[model samples]
Every structure is written in structure tokens, then in C-alpha cells.
Target chain A: MAIIKRYRALIILSIILLGLSLISPERGTQALSLTSASLIDMFSLLPPILVLVGLIDQWVDKQVLIKFMGDDSKFLGVIIALLLGGLAAGPLYIAFPIAITLLKKGANIRYVVFFLGVWTTAKLPIVLFEVAAFGWKYTLIHVSVGLIFFYLVGVFFEKRFDPNTLLKEDITSNE
Target chain B: MSQSIFLYGLIAILTGLSWFKDRQKTKKALMKAKNILVKLAPELLAILLFVGLSLSILTPETISSLIGERSGVIGVFIASFIGTFAMLPSFVVFPLADTLVSNGAGLVQVSAFIATLVSVGFASLPMERRIFGKEFTYMRNLSAMLMAFIFSFIIWVVLPWL
Candidate 1:
């Protein structure tokens, strides 16, 4: 019962898939195949990321992390955050665990937010692809505008929300 | 893919180093990884299902029709909305954007679609909320959506000049 309650959303989604399959077999099977493909992708990507996170959590000293990304780190913190985010691969979802782990290790909220912003918009491989698809001028404008906007958003969010309060649920809830 | 190979290589090196330093600590780290994987499995399944369903319903034809060149600001909004739900990889998304542009979608509309598609993840909100809490999740997504709109507007104005 507890497990079912915890997985209520997935259970509901599965039922919906089943109903859709009953209603239209072709589309339903297609959806199922897509889901399985994504699942395999997730499996391939997530384990290594999780392992890295776990290893970082265990090995990296809190003092060292704080010195680099802590509240007073400021400009240097932002630069480091951008580099980490820009170099990353995979989707926005992949960034969440890494972001939380950084927070857990005393990284400033603003830097963490900046990291997410960069991950979403300015990742290196994605930027290269964007340039190829949209032309250099368009990609330049998009990347610069997105980076500036997200930096401001990061600062704004840091001021608005207390890090301790924002991370409360994550700290307590094991997931 | 190359990314997977790179990731696996990195993990293997790190794991070996960690194990060499302290067997007990490495064991603990692996346990932590297992715990996260177990906890996240269900939410991940839900997210994948949502993506599959949305993609099936929002075919390329439907999207192109909704955001074709003459749709203007309304098209940008529609594109942004659709983007929030669709979560294809960046590699796939760029090509899809190119196809949409060739198929009559405006540059501004496609810009909105690509921007929001990469930045916002409504389908993965549950997982995000679980990690960062509700306020952070909502705020990040809303800000990303606003940024997408602004990006499209910039493109709409500037594309004419260039």
C-alpha cells in the first residue's frame, strides 16, 4: 500500500496508457515503444551520473566545496558554475540531482541556479548544434540573451528564497 | 553513444580511485547511488510515459499547422506552450526545428519552440519538485517560459534586420 501510494502517479500513467491502447492500438503501441526507448536512454545515462554524484558526496570535503561555491565565493562561484553547466550533457532532468548535491555540499543558491540555467540553454554540444541549425548570428544572440537572462533570474531567486527553506523538503525527504 | 562511453569511462576511473582510497567509503557511495535509483524509478517512468503520450498526440503536422509563418505572436505562444510539454533531446530538437522552418514555421515561432523545449520541463515537474521543492520548481519553470517569450520577441525584431 505504501509503495503504491508513493508510485501513484506512475500507476495512473500506466492505466492511461492501457486505456489508450484499448482505444487505439497503433498509436498506443507507438507510445509504448517511445516510452521504452526513453527508458533505455535514461537507464544508460542516469547510472553513471548517480554514481558520480554519490562519489562526490562521499569524497569531496564540505569545506572545499564551500570555499569554491559558498555564499562569499561570488564571481568565482558563478564562473565555476557556468563551466560545470556548460560542459554538461543530457536533459534538464539530469541537472536536478547534480544541483541538489551541490546544494547539499554548501554551494550558494545563486550559483546552483546559474548552473541550471547554463545547463538548459548554453551546453557546449547543444550550442554547436544550435549554431549549425540556426546560423551563427542567431545562435550567438540566443546564447548571449539566455545566459544574461538566466544570470539575472538566478540572482533574483537567491534574494527571494532562503536556501535553507528552499531545500527543506529535499533535505528531509529521501529520494 | 560517445557521451555514454565518456560517462562510463569517467565513472569507472572515479570509482576505481575512490575504492583504492577507502573500500568502506566506496561501498557507502554505491549504496547511496542505489537508494537514489530506487526512489527515482517510479517518477522517471511517469515522466517517460507523459513524454510518449504528448509526442504521439502532437505530431509534426499538427505542430507545423499551429505555428506556421502567418500565426504571428499567437503562434509564438502556442509554440512555447507545446515546447513545455515536449522533451526531445537537443540533437533531435534542432533538426526538428529546421524541418518546421522549412515547412512554413516562422523563425520567431521556432525560436520560442526551441528555447522553451530545452529549458522548461513540465512533464518532469514532479521529479523536479521532489528534488528542489515546489517553489523552486515553479519559479524556475515560469522564469524559463518568460525567457522563451523574450527570446522569441528578440528574434522577431532582429531577424528582420539581419
Candidate 2:
């Protein structure tokens, strides 16, 4: 019963997919295949990424996280956040878990938000592809503008919300 | 695929080294990984299903028509809306955007699409909220959508010169 409750959303979605398949077989099959492909892509990336998160969680010292990305780190914190975010691959959802770990380990909210912003805008591989597809000037403008905007947004939220409260919510929900 | 291989190799090396340093700690890390994976499985499945369903409904041709040259402001709105809901791979997005541009979609609209595509994730919101709670999830996504619109406007203003 507990498992069913936990998976209620997924169960409903599967049922809807099944019903749609009955009405429109071709489109439904296409959707199924695409879903499977995405699942494969996700599985390929998630294990190692999650394992890395786990290792970081267990092995890395909280003091080190605070030293690098805490409120007092200032400009150095921003730089580290950008590097971590920019080097990362995979979708933004993947970043959420990692971000949670960072927050749990004493990283400041501002830098955590900055890290997410960079992940959204300036990942290295995606930047290369964007430049190729949209010209260097366009890519540069988009990335620079995006980075500045989101950094400001991050700072804005950092001022408005208490990071400890957010972290507390994360803990209670997980338990 | 290559990315996966690289990640696997890196994780293998790191895990081995971790085990060498402390077996118990290494086991704890793997156990943590297992817990997260199990917790996230249902949410992941739901996200994948939604992505697949959305993609099926919004075929490339359909998207091209919706954001064509004359689409203007409406096109930007549509593009941003679709982008928020859809989660295409980056490789697919760049090429698709290029195709749309060559086929007469406005640069502003495509820019909006790309911006929101990378930033916002309506489909992944459940997972995000699960991890970060409701307020953070909503704020992050709303800010991203604002950024997407701002980007679209900038591109519109700057594109004629470029």
C-alpha cells in the first residue's frame, strides 16, 4: 500500500498511456519508444552521477564545502559554483539532487542557486554545440546575459529566504 | 553513449580508490546511491512518460508551423510554452532550432524556445519539488521563464545587426 501510494502518479500516467494506445496505436507506440529511449539515456547517466553524489556526501567534509561555497567565500564561491555547474552534463533535474547534497553539506543558498543557473545556461558541451548552430556572437550574448540575470535572481532569493528552512523542508519530506 | 562510457570509467576508478581508502565508507556511499535511486524511480518514470507524450504531440513540423516567421509575439509565447513542457536533448534542440530558423521561424521565437528549453522544466517539476520543496521549485522555474522572455527580447533587438 505504501509503495502504491508513492507511485500513484506514475501508475496513473501509465494507465493513460495505455488508454491512448488503444485509441491511437501508432502515436502511442511512438511515445512508448521515445519514453524507453529517454529511460535508457537517463539510466546510462544517472548511476555514475548519483554514485558520485553519494561519494561526495560521505567523503567530502562539511567544513570544506563551507570554506569553498559558503556565505563568506564571496567571489571565490561564485567562481567555484560556475565551474561546477558549467562542467556538468545531463538535464537540470539531475542537478536538483546534487544541489540538495550541497545545501545539506553547508553550501550557501546564493552559490547553490548560482550553480543551478550556470548548469541551465553555460554547460561546456552545450555551449560548443550552441556556438556551432547559432554563431559565436549569438551564443556568447545569450550565455553572458543568462548568467548575469540568473546570478542576480539567485542573490535575490538568497536575501528573501532562509536557507536553513529550505534545508529543513528537504529533510522532513525525504524522511 | 560516449559520455556514459566516460562517466562509468571515472566512477569505476573513483570507487576503487575509495574502497582502497576505506571499505566501510565506500559501502555507505553505494548504499546512499541505492536509496536515492529507489526514491527517485517513480518520479523519473513519470517524467520520461510525459516527455515522450509531449514529443509525440509536438512533432517537428507542427512546431515549425507554430513558430514560423509571421508568428511574431504569438510565436514567442507558443515556443516558450512548448519549451517549458518539453525536455528534448540539447543535441536535438540545436539542430531542430537551426532547421526552424532556416525554414522561416523567427530568431526571437527560436531564442525563446531555446532559452526556456534549457532552463525551465515543467515536466520535471514534481521531481524538483520533491527534492527542494514547492516554493523553491516555483521560484526557480518562474525566474527561468522570465529569463527566457528577456532573452527573446534581447535577440529580437540585436538580431538585425547580426
Candidate 3:
């Protein structure tokens, strides 16, 4: 029963895929292959990283998190957010779980939002690749404009969102 | 992949160190990890399935053709729509954008594509809403799409000048 509840969406999508296959075998086959590949990618990519977050959760003091990335961390918070986003490697979806981890650990909502923003553009290795592939001028504009723009958006998000409302969903689900 | 290996090695070392410090605490963390994975798996699986379905139809070639340089503002708009809906890794994103541009896709169009590709998540909305609530998810995505348009214009004017 629990399994059915948990996999409801997956089951629905699978049915849709099956229906599509009846209409077009080629597309169905392609979607299935692509999904399996993504499955492998997600498994390989997420476990170690999520485990790392769990360890950080167990080890890092809430107070420590607050001091560094919390509400009043201000300039320091912004820098930390950028570094976290810039240094990471993974799909943008990966950032969500990690951001939740930090937010729950008491990091400021501003930095959490900013961190997710940064991950989209300024991932360091990708940035280096961008410079080589697209040249310095294009790369510089993308990163600088991306970073500055996202930071302002982050500020807007901070004002607009209530962190508790976001995180409250967790508490209800846990029950 | 090297990235996966590096992460595994890092996790192993950290786990060992954590175990050394306090065995009980380390056990708790491991259990926590298990719980977190379980809680997340369902939503993640659903997302992967949807992405697969969408990408099957919206192949990169389809995107590249639509966003050609001559397509102009219309191309930019189309690229934004596609980018917002599609999700790709950063590594794949640049190379794909590079290919599109090489194939005579305009800088501004590709820029919109790349920008919206990273910042927006239309397909991922279901999962995001599950975590962040409905309003924040929609607002964030809308904001990202707007930002992508604004930034694309910035690149259109600025990169040429630079």
C-alpha cells in the first residue's frame, strides 16, 4: 500500500508511456532508454552527495550554520552562497536537496536561494569550459551577469517567501 | 565517471572520520542518510520519467533548428519556452549551445536558451512544488524565465559591444 502511494506518479507516467508506445513504438523506446539512463545517472550522482549532507547535518552545529550563512551573516553569507554554488558539480535538481539541507541547518533563506541561483550558471569547471568554448567575453558576461542578477532575485525571494512555510511541508509529511 | 568516483571517495573518508570521532553519531548519520533517500526517491523517479518522455520528442536537433539566427526575436521566445521546459546538465548545456550557435543559431537566441535552461525548471515543477510549496515554485520559475529574457537582451547588446 505504501509502495503504491509512493510510486503513484511513476505508475501514471509509465501508463502514459505505454499508451504512447501503442501509438509510436519509436518514441516510446527512446523515452524508456533515456529514462533508464537518467536513472543510472541519478543513482550514481546522488547517494554520496546526499550522504555527505547527512553527515554534515549530524556534525555541524545549527549555531555554526547560522553564524556563517544565516540571516545576519550578510556579506559573508553572500560569499558563502556563491562559493557553494560555483564549486559544485551536478544537475540543477541536485541543488534543491542540498539547499534544503542547509536551510534546515539554519542557513539564511537569502543565501539558500542565492546558492541555488549560482549553481545554474557559475559552476567553476563549467565556467572554465565556457571560457574555452565560447571565449572570454561571452563567458565573462554570462557569469557576471548571471551571478549579479541571481543575487538580486535571491533578495527578492527572501522578501517574498517565508522559509517556514516552505519547510513546514516537511513536518507534516513526517507525521 | 570521475565526478562520481571523487564523491564516493570523499564520502568514504568523511564517513570513516566521522566513525572515528563517535561511532554512535556516525550510525545515526548513516540512518539519516537512508531516511532522506527513501523520502526523496519517489518524487525523483517521477521527475526522471517525465523528463524522459519530454526529451524523447524535444530532441536537441529539433531545438537547434527552431532557434536559428534568422528566427530573431521569435527564435529567442521559442528558445526560452524550450529552455524553460527542458532540463540538461551544465556540461551538456554549453556544448549544445555551442553546436546551435555553430549551426548558425543566433547568439541572443542561444543565450536565451542557455539562460532559461539553467535557471528555469518547468518539468521539475511537480517535484519542486512537493518540497517548496506551490506558490514559491511558480513564482521562482516565472522570475527565472523573466530573468532569462532580460539577460539574453543584455548579451545581445553587450557581448557585441564588448
Candidate 4:
């Protein structure tokens, strides 16, 4: 029962796969193949990230993090957050674990939120791709608007929740 | 594949450096990484399955047809919703968006699609909720969706003036 509860989401997904197979075997097979490919993609990418996270956790001093990205760190904090996020090279899901790690290490909620925001908008490689596909005008509006808007959203989130209590739930907590 | 190779190489070099400095701390870091991977397996599996299911059903062809050139306001919402669910590669997404525009999809609709595609993730919600809790995840996604809309609106207003 405990195992079932823990694996319920995966089970539900399996059932959905089964249902799709029953309804449309072709689509089901496509989904299965795609899922497997992405699963491979994820497994490859995730380990180094987790290792990096763990190393950061064990090696970096919390006080140093707090000093750099803490509530009091102003202009420098924003630049670091932008650079850290904008230079990233992965999907948004990749940013979540990294963001949580920074939060756990005493970074300010505002910067953490802003970092996640910038990650979504301004990943450098993707930005270059966007400029090529959509022109500089379209790409510029997205980066500029995304930055200003998300920073304000960060401020809103900062006011809405306390930093220490923001992540009360453990990473494994599904409840 | 090359990205993975590069990352692993970087990890090897870094871990070697740290191991020389402090074997114990280095070991602890690897152990922590192991522990986190164990704990996160279920959520990761869920995300994998969801992405597979979503991608199969929400193919680029399906997305483009739903976002016709004359789709108007309803089309924008549909495009954003599709963007949130579909996890196309950034490389695939730009070209696809470019194709859609050339094939006559409206700029507003395509902009909404592009905005939410990068920022929002309805598909990754379980992993997000598992990590950041329910409220934070909801707030973040909602805010991202809002940003997507605002971005599309800006494109609609500004491009004409430009």
C-alpha cells in the first residue's frame, strides 16, 4: 500500500498509456517511444545537475551565499541572478531543482524568483535562435518585457511569503 | 548527446579537484546527489510520461492547425494552452513558430505560443509541486501565463506602431 501510494502517479501514467494503446495503438506507440527517448534525455542531463547541486550544497558556505544573494544584496544580486539564469542551457524543468537549491542555501526569495523568470525568458542560446527566427524586434520585446515583469512578480512573491518558511515542504513531499 | 558528454567531463574534472581537497566532502556530495535522485524518481517518471503523452497528442501539426491565422482572441488562448502543455525543444519551437507565421498564423497567436512555450509548464507541474509546494507552483505558473498574455498584447500593439 505504501509503495502503491508512492508510485501512484507513475501508475496513473502507465494506465493512460495503456488506455491510449487500447484506443489507438499507433499513437500509443508513438507516445511510448517519445517518452522513452525523453526519459533517456532526462537521465543523462539530471545526474550532473544533481551532482552539481550536491557539491554546491556541501562546498559553498551558506553565509557567503547569503552575503551575495541575501535580502540586503541589491544591484549585484540582480545582475548575478540574471546572468546565472540567462546563460543556462536547458528546459524550464531543469531550472527548478537548481532554483530550490539556491533557496535552501539562504538566497533571497526575490532573486530566486527572478532567476527562474529570467531562465524562462533569456537563455542565451535560445535568445539567439529567437532572433534568427522572429527578428530582433520581436525578440527584444520578449527579453525586455519578460525581465521587468518577472522582477515585479518577484517583488510580489517576496511580499507574499517569508523566505525561511517559503519551502516548508521537503522535496520528496507529494502530500 | 554531446551536451551530456560535456557535462560529464566537467563533472569529472570538478569532482577530481574537490576530491583532492577533501575526499570526505566530495564523497558526501556524491551521496547527496544519489539521495536526491532516489527521492525524485517518482516525480521525474511522472514528468517523463506526461511529456511523452502530451507530445504525441500535441504535435506541431496539431498545434498549427489549432492556431489558424484568423484565430483571433480564442486562438491566442488556445495557443498559450498548447504551449503550456507541449514541451517542444527550443530548437524545434522557433522553426515551428517561423513556419506557422509564414503559413499565415497571426503574430499575436504565435507570440502567445512562443511566450508560454519557454516559460510555462503545465506538464512539469508534478515535479514543480513536489519541489516548491502547491502554492508557489501555482503562483509561479499563473504569473508566467500572465506574462505570456502581456507579451502577446505588447507584440500586437507595438509591431503596428513600429
Please provide TM-scores, in order, for all candidate models, with all chains considered together. 0.95, 0.95, 0.92, 0.94
Error of 3 at A169 (Å): 2.8
Off by more than 4 A, model 4:
A1-5, A170-175
lDDT of 4 at B79: 91
DockQ scores for all the models shown? 0.68, 0.64, 0.61, 0.65
Q: Which ranges of candidate 3 are over 4 A from the true structure?
A: A1-12, A171-175
Of the two candidates 2 and 4, the one with more favorable TM-score, higher being better, is: 2
Tell me the docking grade of candidate 2: medium
In candidate 3, residue A170 scores what lDDT?
Answer: 54
Tens digit per residue, CA lDDT, model 2, B1-162: 898899999999999999999999998889888878877878888989987888888887788889998888989999999899889876577888888888778889999999898889987887888788889899999999999999999888986787
Write one digit per residue (lDDT tens) for candidate 3, span B1-162. Answer: 898888889899999999999999888778777776677777888878877887788776787789988898899999999888777656778887888788778889999998888878875775677677888888878877887888889888887777
Q: After the best TM-score superposition of candidate 1, give how far the Cα of residue A24 lies from its true spot, in angstroms.
A: 2.0
Q: In candidate 3, how many Å is residue A119 off? A: 0.5
lDDT of 1 by residue, A58-94 (tens): 9889999998999899889989988999999988898
Best by DockQ: 1
Clashing pairs in 4: none
**Residues B1-162 of candidate 1: C-alpha lDDT, one tens digit per residue:** 889889999999999999999999898888888877777777788889987887777787889989999999899999999999888866688888988898888889999999999889977887888778888899999999999999999998897798
True contacts kept of each: 0.66, 0.61, 0.61, 0.69
DockQ of 3: 0.61
Model 1 scores a C-alpha lDDT of: 0.87
**lDDT per residue as tens, model 3, A21-88:** 99999999999998888888887778887778778878999999999999899999999998999989
Q: Model 2, chain B: what is the TM-score?
A: 0.96
